[model samples]
Target: MLNRANKLKLRDLRLIKAIAETGQLALAAERLAMTQPAASRMVSGIEQSIGAPVFERHPKGMTPTAVGKILARNAAGLLKGMDQTLADVQSAITGQSGAVRVGAVTGAAVGFVVPAIQKLKKTASGADIHVDVAPSDVLVEGLLGGEYDFVLSRIPAGTDPRQFQVRRGRVEVIRFLVRRDHPLAGPGPLKTADLAGWEWVAQGLRTPLRQAIEEAFVSRGIPLPDEIVNTSSLLVMFAYLGSTDAIAPTSREVAELVAPTSGASQLAALDLEDPIIINPYYHLISMKNQSLSPIAMQLHDLVYAALSGES
Candidate 1:
């Protein structure tokens, strides 16, 4: 029932977050440089404003109520924004360097963003580049919520397409990869059915590649084999493939770039011949409504140029 008129104050939000984190009024108050009584009053005011209790006062300390947890999460986001804004303002006024927060999918992070960032470091010596590699959903959500400046990911789905400005990047070729000595690594024409028995190292269930794999099996009337492992970490995937006989469906560009260099020299593509038909392209995505900073713009151009050849 809360609205603009009843919005919580910055101090109240901070106090709530502190209380949630510390689990004790005295500790939270001390951290905030306020008396315990004042901190208690602030929590009361917040609870009353929201027409619900925000915490459970326990004998040990305190625990956030469901409503309290929701508010605390939003408070964290708001505080992060405030902190970034202050830093940005200082950077602009003092001609000091600022940071570019970038989120990217595994393929793009490996294939383009990481290299572009390395090159950018030589040119923009003072700027900071922070990169996060996650699934497209996580990256897209962070980009839309202001947690990221931009994302190198698939064209975000389930939203208004026009709300985003997207630059075409590399098209990822879905490759079925395995260790060099895997049972299916011999000199014979590989068949899709040949992959039926081996355990799989899969991406998360909701990811685009995973979904495509699921559909491919369903269309062929084959139930997916029991996945031995599910993860998004490229390193873990490589390590697992190197040590085990698990098959991994991965982007061709990433597999090629990582296999030879990651000390997993025996890792190689299964000659499956037929490529997994999935939309494997990377896009440099940012909000249509948000304007990019000079540094961010420069980095964006670098990523686009680096990835354009593969599109």
Candidate 2:
């Protein structure tokens, strides 16, 4: 019996993908620059190696079987990875002036990372920037796994600080936001008690930011609101805050940038009479011992400077 891993080859995977995409053996064979008989033999070999029928043949075309679908999906991933590898090698040959992969938390993505990339592009037009916006914990995981060149987000608790080169930036003060027309919106500073009557939109319970907000309520002696909308999506939170009188706690930068662009532009930050004192600093983190590509290093510096308020 042939082992799955040992029998699989790059050319075979490519042929599988081409067959699945074209649906006709003749078309797929033409694309691969092979004779139809040779393509048929190749498909037969793959099926024999796997001990299963990979496709269902009909008069018009072919359809992938369940096993075939799984193989095709994996083939696509493998091909993509190979393409990225080739691109990276080419970038190395060209002296590191290519793609720079970066990840960031929501606040940094909007307030810092995007702006920095825009500025970098003016001079380094040859650079390709890919940015992922995710929660701090998720971004940190990507940084540690070598999926990202670096990340503009805070390191999670319990992570070994020695594993990363961390550059800490300004603390982002949390802001409580509500619609401009909300009943609690007024000239006088608003108290937590004033918000007790309204519903709230909150991040997922497991998130650090949500835990801090809950802590703030406990410290203020306000019974945590039982009525809450829990979600990780900022769009959903802002939509609820704008359309309804729901209150939410977020970074000041997020509240400022999202409110105007969200179409429901009536959202405004509240002046809390007793403000929540949760300020999480942003950190630019890269792998500890690994040297970054020159392009990636330049992009990292740009992001750090922007977040740190340096020229």
Candidate 3:
């Protein structure tokens, strides 16, 4: 019986994978930055231990035997699992596991995510969280790939949830924003034409809400300003709004970051009569590893409770 210690390990699996990938011993060695002799030795060592000639020599290049093909297939799965293990370890040591790695679209971070973390801290004192703020599509990808334990994003209008294991949480409003002193802050009816001259800070043009809004302006033959901003940075946008006459539109939950100081409301949120509903926020989670640590579970509950309080 072959002792487990002498059996194929990560190194052997890597050698086989490299050989399969490059299709030649000399080239595989070059790809791995090792000498041809070293590569040959590795292949021989594996063959001796496994008691099978794993590869066939041909004029064109090397090819795996039938048994070698089976080994390679199994090796791929093993290597993938090993890679996941290493990544999980790194993420946890760097503060990402045994806890929730939550992702949110840009709008939710400053106001909703930060405050929600604070609230979760009060109860789940020992839990850890790693938060990522990104565009909706990116965060959803992370959530689906198991890189994120949970995620927060609005369901874009006309979005099909079929590809995701979605959990609808709650609906929320988004509105246009301007510095309180801006000319339209106390306004009655300001149309797209009012925003023609000044550079406007907006979500990416590809985003559903932003795209739809821009389409409306274009359809009306209103010439958009020369300036276009594409950052999901709320604080930066808020600062710009505070400094100049720029206006930003975002979610109500996200807009909570703008609590005015000194009895001066530095910002005022506006509802668009022809406004677009940014999206409906949901508690998005990965389909993989349905098993979550106690802490991860607790964090999810806290966020759910906080949103529930609003209803």
Candidates 1 and 2 compared by lDDT, better number: 2
lDDT of 3 by residue, 61-174 (tens): 889998788778888899999999997776545434456788877655654567777876765554567999887777776766779777777544465666555656555555
Report the poorest 10 consecutive residues by lDDT, candidate 2.
Answer: 258-267
Taking all chains together, each candidate's TM-score versus the true structure is 0.63, 0.65, 0.57
* Highest-TM-score candidate: 2
Q: Report every candidate's CA lDDT.
A: 0.80, 0.81, 0.70
TM-score of 3: 0.57
Cα deviation of 265 in candidate 1 (Å)?
A: 1.1
- Candidate 1 local lDDT, 42-85, one digit each (tens): 88888878888999998999999999898889899999999899
Off by over 4 Å in 3: 1-98, 154-163, 169-172, 187-193, 216-223, 259-265, 281-283, 308-311
Per-residue lDDT for 113 in model 2?
85
Report the Cα lDDT for residue 234, model 2.
85
CA lDDT, candidate 3, residue 141: 68
